[model samples]
Target: MALWTLFGLRQGSATTRWPAPGGDDGQADVLGMPRYHPERCGDGCSACADACPTGAIVADAAGGLEVDYSRCIACQLCVEACPDGAMTASGDWAFGVRRREDLRWAESGDPPASPAPTAGYRRSLHIRHVDAGSCNGCESELQALNNPIYNLHRLGIFFTPSPRFADLLLVTGPVTNAMIEPLKAAYEAMPEPRWVMATGTCAVSGALTGGGYAAQQGLGDILPVDVWLPGCPPNPAAIIEALLMFLDRMPQRVRGGQYGE
Candidate 1:
């Protein structure tokens, strides 16, 4: 019976190399924001600026473009508005911070710590994930880490089911009322010197459904968020970038200006 069960395991599947199509290869994009080509830009039409849902893109008198990524929604609207294809979205996605002030716009804080030089300093992190009330988008991306393409284990990062053994807590969803106690208990159960990572728009700023009755306060209101992964359930590569950013394995960016400015 044991041999039959062992034989039941699926095998003989083709294996792909690291960074299988559409996988992040650990290269941080120094230019974390999008870049615009002025030559390809036409006159000051303001279509891209108007199309911007968050008003991240603006036009100048010289028919040039300005993008405040701190406000940009990364909706790709500007890329679609450019008739000449002047706007292009770059893959550079490393963005993480240790303090809210560091992430806050118009607030200059102390510089982040320099990345550890030796790979040995990179600790093996055991992550515990909790779904407060997410739409399951964040969970989907989290699962991608197990895929051979991303292979998070290569970096010594792992996901564990038990919170007691976890070194980091990866949370999804906007802290719903029903989940508050569970979330708090989970954090309290973990060992000291632990980290909490809030992934997705719901967990970060609450995004659209923040004011809902079921939604509790933001993740920050409940716990000290060590990392914030902003997106409507960010892409797999984006998740990898955020995780790497938190570990100080990539360059960090200090965005300027106000939150809604």
Candidate 2:
């Protein structure tokens, strides 16, 4: 333990100054969800939809294609399958939103305005995480938040064991049948003015494991969600951005299935 402590001291401060303007949020070369180009799509093309594992890309009623960000696992399958340049890979990963409709791709119209941040949770926020039916992928990323490199506590976000003291409920996995009652019990234990964040693609739209015998269609099937973060397992920086966005400290970057819109 003494040698390890000495090694830690020598490494100095490993935490990043991310989420601050001009700071590095890590994810330098990482490719996020695919970018959809409606103009490039062919009239009879459904290749992207056919290749998608999560049903994130589908044919609309107007003989057009629609991309839903919530169900996307960022596997880049659609990008590879598109004969045209319609579905292309991108680096736009900071996908946190207040409304579910904001995650869908629409050619026109604006998304519904999100409510202002609660006054009580501006500076500090307490989170209680529940694994409804996770595959442990999201939990692995969540554990990294406390490591020396990420150091989640520096941003005033913390995980609490007790729901009564938590300001937000962070849920993972595809809301399985067995865990539904337990998940509700945790929500009921929390005080009023509480918020819920769907932390992964499973929690956001259940990804590939949804609609089976046990799993439901993510947390929206059971709880009122204030934030929806979609990824197979979102990186640490993306998670931070989502939480901050939920607190209204950061702007929602993805709207109508487009990034930076």
Candidate 3:
């Protein structure tokens, strides 16, 4: 025990002070969501759209690229596939939003100019996670919140094992047909003034499993969502930032799927 304590003291405080200035978390150099400059695209180019494994980059009827941030997994294939300089790699990882439409490139707008926290959870937030049918990448990232680096517990946010004591439902997966009832039941179990967060591309936009005969279109299509954190699986730092933003501990950096100051 003494040896372990000595090792712990040597390690010191590994927790990040990010979202509090003067802190460089691990995501600074990581490639986050891809940014698109539609004006730079070719007149009728469909390269980016074709390269997207998910239907994230579909072509609109007017021949314009429709990039949905929710379905995007940061695969970067679209960036490499674009013949023109329209799609460029970016470090914009903070993709959480209060509205589902904000996940669309064309429709996204800056978050409301208010720092007002969610009424009941301004200081502390408790989340209940449900995996309807996820591929588990999101789950891996979620677990990182407890690591020494992120130290999510320091922010007064905890993952309760039961929905009945939770203030928010942080859901992952594609909302499979087999899990819809359970998901809803979990949501119902949460206390009043409860909110729902769609965490991951699959839960926000249903990824590859959407519109199937046996599953739901997305979490928002089935339940009223208060926040949408989209990624193939949002990185640990991104997830922490999103949760803090929801708690009013930080400002929202994403508007209309574009990262900003």
Candidate 4:
């Protein structure tokens, strides 16, 4: 027998049974987007907002800070800068949502309910990914989906080369001016009832490079997005969670910039 075959037999299956109850999703001790505790905010403290490189947190009209999760790169600068416990690091990585507004932090009122999953994509999903101008961080995580540890195909989700056959358009990077036409072309090629997913913070809000001379902001102006997943580069498991949330196989965990429900 081949050496690889022998190793495989010895280790059994390396793939995780995640997205199912009790299965490991492989992210342990990983820090995700920062958690904002408005109650713990110190009087007139602007440390967190000032430290945020991507302008994810900014001064609101009330002199308080407003957090836009879409622009957050999860660098933990705000958490480190906060004298109070208002901004703290967290492990809540699943930040996928259908609406862009839900990614902003809100102090009161009920969280928006998750939109019903599209009936047609419940069983399987085919994705077409575009790299507009990424640093390849998101692409690295995406490649891991096919590794033995992830085995993404087991879940019936796949990455297809052709946009015409894809159900979702997964985009990475802060789209550059050069890619605008091509990106639109890809979206146009997809059949009707297709969905779009902004796969990283760069794609969701242009990250630290928004409004540059060469790069446009995120996909907000370019195309309609059905799922917005923000991370500097979201891990493989988080990406999986986002897909499931889109298909309604799992409940959305983040709303109003808070993790959970």
Question: Where does candidate 3 stray beyond 4 Å?
Answer: 107-117
Which candidate should be chosen as best, given TM-score against the real structure? 4
lDDT per residue (tens digit) for residues 77-159 in model 3? 99999989799999888888777667788544564554434844554788999998888999999999999888888889999
For residues 12-117, write the lDDT of model 4, one tens digit per residue. 9988878777889888899999888888887788999999999999987787998999999999989999999898888888988888888998875247586654
- Write model 1 residue lDDT over 1-261, tens digit each, in one string: 687556655543222333344533553553233445556767776778777765456776777666544344456778777777767766545444445444433333344454422234466778999998898987887887777566778767888989999988888888888999999999999987788987876777665556578796459889988776666556666676567667766545544322210
Q: Candidate 4 versus the native: TM-score?
A: 0.96
Model 2 segments more than 4 A misplaced: 117-120
lDDT of 1: 0.66
What residue pairs are clashing in model 3? 108-256, 109-256
C-alpha RMSD (angstroms) for model 4: 1.3
Scored by Cα lDDT, where does model 3 land? Answer: 0.85
Extract clashing residue pairs from model 2: none
What are the lDDT scores of the predictions, listed in order?
Answer: 0.66, 0.89, 0.85, 0.89
What C-alpha lDDT does candidate 2 achieve relative to the native structure? 0.89
Worst 10 residues of 2 by lDDT: 114-123
Better structure of 1 and 3 per lDDT? 3
TM-score of 1: 0.65
Positional deviation of residue 178's Cα in model 3 after best superposition, in angstroms? 0.9
TM-score of each: 0.65, 0.95, 0.93, 0.96
